[model samples]
Target: MWSGDELDLDAYLARIGYDIGRDGELAPDVRTLTALHRAHVAAIPFENLDVALGRQVPLDLKSLQGKLVDRRRGGYCYEQNSLLAAALERIGFQVAGRGARNRSRGATLPPVTHAVLAVTIDGEQWLADAGFGWQGVLEPVPLRAGARVEQSGWTFGIGVEDEGIHVLRSLRPEGWTDLYAFSPQTLYPGDFTVMNHYSSSHPQSRFLGQVVAQRPGADVRRALVRETLSSVRADGSAEERIVDTADLAVTLEAEFGIELDSEERARLERLHAAGV
Candidate 1:
């Protein structure tokens, strides 16, 4: 478990652009939790650069803090949610790690590759996840059947399927899209270690050959998938373009705030150019 003392709480708070004193309330309430969630997504992006670079993704608090907070880099679900869970625990919120499966196409028995959080605050349980990329939930919603939440012009709902697994859905123009599904089973650190290893190292892992980075702004969300750059507005409209090979480094830095060294940049350029 990650303790507050294990990391620099002040620095972590600053990295998320959260103001503790200014809020004048230090208790772990809905307001604080929502603010923290919003700040985290806005500050630390959802990225898979290390996987693309063939670097091991570390799950330890020290490494996560050093990379995400200290270096101002972004990470995927495991890192982002782990960091948020630790911070919430430090702030006196009752948090438990949960795992989920991608259910984009209503696939019933998908592998539990995604990580989420089950938080209990003031005798109510809520779902909080900071690493769902572009279509992530913006705030913690009550863990109740048929509960609906509207955030930043997007609508999300939580419900349980017939199989007794909780499913999260997003409101789309056509209909509700099933984002992911998971049971109420609690996940331990070791489980995440196994899942993370497969996600970051396995040859068949989708993240291995792709470069994905996403960050949500106040009105627009930016996502970079391989060589394509997409910007989606709050109204669900989107604009996309294929990035030139020569401009990849500059675009990554300027648009996504990800700065890689010359060698790293060259490697990514080659990988994307080859389209392997």
Candidate 2:
């Protein structure tokens, strides 16, 4: 029941790259969720391209849409999920911000590290995620247990964990694997920014350490840096590519719609060379 003023519709739509006047009505059923999910995946990519290049990424609504929807840039969890929350709310859907786990290398349980969305439509609550790096959910899944929901060649399930926490899982041929956990709590921008700062700045931060891998889907893409490695899948197989310093600027602009100046470019090159 979080209430903010009705968002500025036209500006928001333009920012997200949808022409508003033509499509006055948005489908409100499962189809609506599916369409939005597709548009999000196709339009907004899961990338730390900017951060890796030593750029500052803001999570405010104006900046989020301005980059993704307006300027045609992509972003990480906070940027993608925040703008999505705004879009859903503007179109009369109930949405809340929430946090999710960032799986650790040796831990049995996933660690909380990113932001996501909880949406309620037609009295049924669902988890809506647009920023999970490579393994993100591509469709809305019901907020109930023992039910398998399919999304972009992946299946999801919800189950109750200890302490009454809700766990989200991805189903593979082997079995079910935990993705993240959360209570039925609503988060605000400040909440996400705190986590964002930690992930972006900490020395142990994976993003800062090396190149990371992320693919929105099959035929989409993947990235590999000196310290990071990633594979993208469009048809469910991995597509891996290595980018060099020579390709960095063009890749950011062409792949993520980010514009960098000469000084920013020099700084990014230095950071890439330093690998810190």
Candidate 3:
């Protein structure tokens, strides 16, 4: 029920740089699923500029398509994963939404906020998350106990916790770090809309007064949180720098592959300068 029929499938395919001749044909299979997930994350970045700009982040298909596909803009998890779910559903794949709690911050458990997709191919199911910012998987991870996937040189694994909770983790130089944990209970688009309201508008929301953009590449992962832009390598070493207001627009365009129009750029520049 992701309204896949209404989605512009061809445009979505083109937006992700999916090539039928090279990436394989569109089908409800693991190969196509992997290609689409990988391409979507690599092409479309992860950012929350609208939230910082005090603009509404709409979840409708037309708004998603207009901002993400046509405008060539990036968005946070709700927008990112919703667009991916629509695209996957349009391609004859069975897709469902899952709400996940952010665990990377610390031992304190956060609320269920992140949106991911559960894609079933044949009798086997896969965790296809095209959002998740800098600490996300490049391709789908199999939905099972102790599932380990190696994308390029990076490593990711799944662990089953008590009460049927599933944890997604990344292997670091020291040990395995928990990225996020999700339950088996499926979430709907309406559920996401409710959560999106809090994330986009709430005063205490981390996205409200910050400039966050991320791109997790095979070789390096870069995240711009507020003024600092940090780039981490596969070995877990990171280098960070401050992004001044004067360099905000160029940094977003050149580093994150996000281009803003004149008005959008002006608003965002002012926000960045205010340190909000």
Candidate 4:
């Protein structure tokens, strides 16, 4: 169980660009949660830079704050959601950590590799996730069947499948797409540590040799995968281009706000050259 007693609330708020003082009172309500969610996704991008650099992504609150908040770096699902969970709990919100299996189209349902939050406020349960990279939910939604939530013109909903699994779906021009499926079972800190180790270091893990950076905005989401830069608009339109090796560093810093050091830059260049 992760406790929020030692979380640096002030530093976390500043990192996410959220001003709780402006609201006069720190309330654990839907409005505040929505604002915080939006701010988090906007300010802190979703990236696998550490994994690309062959470093283990830490889950402790202090280490997360140091890397994501103080150093201005982003992280993958485990790291990103863990940081948000700590901040939310410190603000008096009821939070529980949950794990999920990737159920998106064409994805093999592997062991639970995703972490999300189940939050309760005023007798209602909500699903909040700040780490899902590109096609993730932008705002917390009611944890009910057929509950629809609109975010930046994108529509998302929750559905209960057989055996009580909650499936998150997104609306597209074609039809609804399954994002992932999860149960309400609470996951302990040790569970996440084991999964994080596999995710960050396994030979076949997606994060190991790939470079992924994503930043969601009000109108569009920018994502970089290897040499491809894609801008996915909220209206179901997308534009993609292949970035040259010479422009990779500048594109990463400018488009995704990731300023890599010389060593990291060289490492990424080498990965691209090897076509891994």
Candidate 5:
């Protein structure tokens, strides 16, 4: 089920700094679920550097483990969420994938390019996502309408929409802002592969021509897209500053906790110089 047995559970727990699971008490209960979600978000970052480098984003559990776990690299929604799903399933949690449309971009509805997870505990489903990058919930959000939760002083909520869709929103100083909208329809690993193709190679894909990395921190969220670095405080105030190519690697490591090898670093800097 979801290639759980193929995952290196102990390695994953250590990667995310989750000790409770190390002693083998890692339950499929909500407490462990929430803790795992929180730790994973803080440890593994969200990034699209590989796609920007014109590489394929693999979704298999083996490739996911190699890049995200062994290599200590960050990935976008599909890779991040898939790794999480494998860990959850390995621990006996019922997990399913859901496709989501990114709404934070603007009024126009984006495609269902995002991947998320739904976990069931005692018949109650919870929204557990670790791949949403900058505007993601730090804990497992209830999979119900009008459900709200406060995580690390940051607030989040779920709202209902037309056609039984569920929208994930964050509470900002100005008001609630939509992060993404997802339907209850469960997606499979194969579905994610198809979407990944478009995201990695499609000419019109946002990730195709630029670098994107994000860290959703409690006090402030950080997003590094292409040549710009944006920080949004919990109070809703924000700042955007251009990141010089020379400082890109440092910014990625210091802000998003991502470090690339020398060749990869040189390639990224070249991509930047080439106006990507």
Candidate 6:
């Protein structure tokens, strides 16, 4: 429910820089979905800079809104996906918060590390994800299988990652490669705390190790901390950059549109230097 129309909708949109209308119904057309996806890509960046800096990445709604929609900060999947869900819901889209796991990482990894959205309109479920870093899709992929969901020329397919996990696969010249997996499980904010801790603290986690990503443009996505910052084109093959954090705050603002305070910057720099 909205806060008696006193909520700052424009500020919220400005925080994310998502150009979509804040007070109107989310347009159900494919064009709207594409545009929204691009806005998210250009606006919300995928960065673990906060965790590396020892800042607590809170999952509560107010905290999330303040950091992501007010302070113009970037966050990991749960925060990014969760905030987007709130905005879409306010715009009159029937959105469902779904859980996902990284099948490529390992089967035993904790659940709910990834969050996705299932938007229903005209009784059809459309996949809307703003949080699956690097290989993130820029449009709603159809939920049906064998039905190729083509965007910007590349084709995607939906299938089973496991009994309970549904996977998104990219149709390449060689074969279909797994993209990511999600379940119908709707999670509360509390479910993410542990995962966030692991992602931020666990040395074994890829994010904790090193990875750099930026949403340079609506359709342009890149990251290098993984040793490869790849930018996927409408066509599948991508251009890559080596990841490094020389001037992190500048990168945050330039690449992700995040504005960090001096205290926040000092904390982040300290953490990065400590590598904890």
The candidate scoring highest on lDDT is 3
- TM-score for all models, in order of appearance: 0.94, 0.80, 0.98, 0.95, 0.96, 0.78
Ranked by TM-score from best down, the candidates are 3, 5, 4, 1, 2, 6
Better candidate by lDDT, 4 or 5 = 5
What does candidate 5's lDDT look like per residue over 1-276, in tens digits? Answer: 589999999899889888863533788899889888888998999999999888878889999999998989999889989999999999899999999999998798768899899999999999998988888988899999999998877899999999989999988887889999999999999999998998899888988878899999878889998899999987678999999889989999999888988988999998887775
Runs in model 5 with CA error above 4 Å? 21-24
Q: Which has the higher lDDT value, candidate number 2 or candidate number 4? A: 4
Model 4 lDDT tens row, 73-187: 8888888888888878888888888888887746676888898899899989999999888888778989999999888898999999887899989888888888889997888
- Per-residue CA lDDT of model 6 for 120-217, tens digit only, reads 77787778887776566767877765557766665778885455567877766767777677876766545556677777777766676443455534
What's the TM for model 4?
Answer: 0.95
Clashes of each: 0, 11, 0, 0, 0, 3
Best by TM-score: 3
Assess each prediction's global lDDT (C-alpha) against the native.
Answer: 0.85, 0.66, 0.91, 0.85, 0.89, 0.64
Whole-model lDDT for model 1 versus the true structure?
Answer: 0.85
Residue 30 miss distance in model 3 (angstroms): 0.4
Write down the TM-score for model 2. Answer: 0.80
RMSD of each: 1.6, 3.4, 0.9, 1.4, 1.5, 3.9
Stretches of candidate 4 off by over 4 Å are none
Give the CA lDDT, 0 to 100, for residue 64 in model 6: 75
Alpha-carbon error at 274 in model 5, in Å? 2.5
Clashing pairs in 5: none
The predicted structure with the larger TM-score, 3 or 4, is 3
